[model samples]
Target: MASPLRFRRSSERWNDDRIIEELYSHLDSNLGARSVTPHYVGPDGFETRRFEMDNGDMALFTWNDDFAYWLGNTETPPALWRTSKYTFDEVPYQIARWGQRELLADLTVESPWLAKYDYLSWFFLPVLFSKDGRETSRAFFRKYDAGFPDTTRDEALSFYERFLRTGALDDYRYTMASKLGTSQYFDKNRMSSAMSEFTVAKLLTEAGYDVIPEIEVTTGHSLDFRADPRNGSHDQSSLVEVTRPQPPTQRAADTPVAALRETAETKSNGQLNEHGGGAVMFVDCSGFRDDEWSAVVGEQPDVRHRPAVVFRARPSGAIDAYKKGSVPLSLSQAVEWV
Candidate 1:
C-alpha cells in the first residue's frame, strides 16, 4: 500500500499580497511567458483597476468564499481559478498562485489515483484501467496524501515521467466511454435512466419485495435486476426481470418468451427450492404499447401459474392500467423508500 497524501488546512490571516508576490516570483523563474496578469473581481462584481499584476501569463485572483466568512468579514481573498480539462464546461477555482490551470491539468493526468476522490478530472480512467489490467494506481493516490513538499514533488514527478514512458495513460484513456455527444440533453437521459431504476427498486421494496440491481448472479451472467426473499421468508422470495424500452417498434410474432419461461422455471426449481417456497416471474416495465404487449403475450405459455406483468411507467407518476392484477408503479408512487 502507498502512503497517503497530506492536505493543508486554511491558515488564519495570511498576507494575500505577499503570497501573490511569492507566486509571481516563482512563476517568473519557472514559467515566464505563460503567466498573465492576475485579475481581481470584487464583491460589488466590479474589477479592481490599480495594483494589478500583468506579466503575460493569464492569472486571476479571487476571494476564498469560506475564508471570507471565517474572518467575520464579507471580503473574499483573491485566488487563482481555472477551467478544468476533465469535465465539460467545468471550471474549478483554487488558492494556488502558480501554474493555475496548467498545473491542475498536469497533476490530474499524471496521478491516476487522485482522480478517484474528485479533485478535478474524471476518475473513471484509472478505475477502468484497474479493472482491465492488474496495475494499481491506488498507491499513487496514497502518496499524494503524504503532503506536497520538495521530496514528494520529486517523487511525484519521477512517477509521472515513468508513467508517460510506459504509455499506461494511453490504455487508460482508450477504455473510457466517449465524452463526445454528451450534451445536456444526453445528461438528462442518463439521469432519467438512473431515476427510473431507482423508482423500480423503491416500488419493489414498498410492495414487500427485496430488490437488488445490477447483480452478477454467476461469473459471467449478470441481471439488470432481481428481487427476492419477500414476506420474511427466504424460501418464499421472488425474482423480477426489468427492461427499458427503446422507441416504439413492431413486435415479432415469435418473441423470446419460451427462453424466459425456461430460465424462470430452472431458477425456481433449482435456486428457489433451497429457500423454501419462492416463485419466479418476469416484470416488463418497458413502456411498450398495448399492441406490443399483446404480441408478447401471444407467444407466452397459457399456464396460469407462470404469471407475467407488463406495464408502462411514466415520469409524471402515472402507471398504465394493470393487466390481470399486475400493478405498474412509478417514481412518485414509490417515494416511500427514498
Candidate 2:
C-alpha cells in the first residue's frame, strides 16, 4: 500500500496577470516563443490560448475556467483547470519521463491545475509503455506490482526513476491499474476487472505464452486472456479466465470455485473450437487457500470440463494447480501440457 493522494482546493483570489504568469511558467518549457492571449469562453468553460514550441510542437493551453469566479470571493477555490495539446504526436516514454519531472517539483505555488494533471499522467502515461509492445515490461510490472506506489506523487517519481534507469518499467502498469481501481476518477468494477485481466495476461506472457487480453471469442463472451504456447500451434493454446476472489467478509452469493467452474464450462464444449485446446482458470486465492479450493473441486470427480485446469493464485505470486489426473506442472509447463 502507498500513501493516499491529496488535492488542495484554494479559495485565494487570483488576478489575470498572476494566472497568466503561472500558465506561461508551466507551458513555456515545452512551448518555445509564443504570445499570450486569453479569451473568456463562459462560466464552466475555459480561458484558452495557443502557442508554438521551439521543437515545432504546437500547443493549446487552457487556464482555470473557475479562476475568474474565485477572483471576487475567497470562499472555496474553484476547481483548477488546465489542458495542453501538441501539434505533432509525442512518444509515451518521453511523456512519462516528462511527467516524472513535473510531479517531483512543487506546483502548488504556481499552478495546481497542471500538478493535478501531472499526477494523473503518472497513472495514464505508463499505459503507453505497455501499449508500445513491451510485453516483458508489462509482465515484470504485473508480477511485482506490490513493490510500486499507487498514490502520492513523490513516491511515484521515485518508482519512475528506478523504472527508467533499469529500463524495465516494472510494476508500472499494475500500479496504475491499482490507482484507477481505488481512485474516485473511474468506475471501480471496470477498473478492478481490467487490472485483474491485465495481470493475468502478463502472467501468462511471462509464463512463455503470447497472450491477448480481453479477447472476444463470440458475441457477449470475452475471456480474460487467450494465449498460445510460445513456439507451438494454435491447437496447443488455452483460453484463460481470471478472477479476484473475495474474502468471507466480502463474499457475496457465490464462491470462487463456482465462479471459476461457470467460466470454464462456458467454453468447454467446442466454444473455442480448435483454436484452444482447453481452458485455464486462475482465482486470486489470496483470500482462500489450495486446500479450500481442492475441497470444492474434489467433490466433482467427473468435472464438466474434462481438461479444465484451475489455478489458485496467491497474493505473493505463488500458484497451485488443480487439474485431476494431470501432473503437477508450472503455469508455463501447463501451457503445452497434453
Candidate 3:
C-alpha cells in the first residue's frame, strides 16, 4: 500500500528558476495551488515552500544541491512525476530532517494541543499530523490515553513512547499510524482496537521476534501480525490475531473473565474461525488491574481456540503473560508467566 507520508525523490537537473516555474504552472493549473515566498532555508537548500491547494491539500517542496523532494497529502506534482518514492528513513538524512520539520510544523498547526508532548508528537507524526486524520488522531491520544483505561495519561503515553523510540514500526508508519486516525472520529472502541496492535507489537519484538503487520491470509482477511524469530534459528513464523477485551466495568459482561471470554469468543467465531486455526489468538487483558487479573489467571477460561495467549501488560515494561495450546514462539524472556 502506498502510504501518505512517503517522499518523492527527484534528481532532475532543471535549474532553480525553471523548476519553480514548472511547479507553479503544474500546481496552479491542476490544483489551483498557491504559494508565498519561502520563509525558511531548508537543509543545504536555498528555500523551502509550502503550497496550499483550493481542494484543501497542501504540498511541500524543498530543493537542495542537485536533488528535490516533493511531499504532501496531494498527488505528486508533474515536476516530480516518474520519480521513485522513499519512506522517512530511506531518504537522505538532511532531506529527512527537513521534511520532518515541515511535517511537524503542519501537525502543530492542526492540533496545537499536542505541542507540549515531545515523544508522542514525534512517534505518531505520520498519522497525528496527516491531512485527513490530524484532529481526530490527536484527540485519540490526548483524550483516551491511547486506549489504556485506569492508567494515568502520562503513564500511558510515557510507556508507549519508549516502545516507539525503538523504531520497531517506523517502516510501517503510514499504515500503522493512520489506523489511529481514519477510524470514525473519536469512536473509542474502533480507535482503541487500533492501539491494541501496537501493544502486541511491543510484546512480540521484545520477545526476540520480528513482528510484521497486516498479513493477508487466504481467507481474504488480514491477520494482525506475523512473528518471526529474530534469530536465524527458526525457519517458521507464527501468525497472530489480537483481540482486546473491554475492561469489565465498561462492558455488558459483569466480571473481568466474563467480559474477556465474551470478547474472545466473538473473535473465535468470526475471523479466527474463517481463518481455520493456524494463527494464535492474542487476548490483551491489559486494561485489567492486579485484582481483576488475579481472577482471570485463576480461571484461565478457554478463548474457544487452540494456540491462544492471554496476558496483561503495564506501561513500565513489566508484562505478565501465559500461553495456551502449545504456542511455537518462546516469550518467556519478555514475559513473566502468571
Best by TM-score: 3
**Tens digits of per-residue lDDT for model 1, 1-338:** 21111112232333457544644454445444233332323333222111222332223333342332111001122322221112211222333212133323433555644542332123222231222111223332243311112234344334333323433223323222121112212232232233334344545554555565544554344444566656564444444444333323322223444333443355445434443432333333333444554454565343222333434433333344233223232223333210
- Which lDDT tens digits does candidate 3 get at residues 229-302? 88775557999999989888888899988988899999999999999999999998887777888899998888
Return the clash pairs for model 3, or none. none
Which scores better on TM-score, 2 or 3? 3
For model 3, state the Cα shift of residue 308 in Å.
Answer: 0.8
* lDDT of prediction 1: 0.34
- Candidate 3: what lDDT? 0.78
Error of 1 at 54 (Å): 19
lDDT (C-alpha, whole model) for all candidates: 0.34, 0.40, 0.78
Error of 3 at 12 (Å): 9.4
Better of 2 and 3 by lDDT: 3
* TM-score (all chains, Cα) for each model: 0.30, 0.43, 0.78
Can you tell me which runs of candidate 2 are displaced by over 4 Å? Answer: 1-95, 104-195, 218-221, 231-235, 252-281, 289-294, 297-307, 324-338
Number of backbone clashes in candidate 3: 0
Positional deviation of 157 in candidate 1, in angstroms? 47
Better of 1 and 2 by lDDT: 2
**lDDT digits (tens) for residues 24-71 of candidate 2:** 444454444464342223223434443434533232333253422211
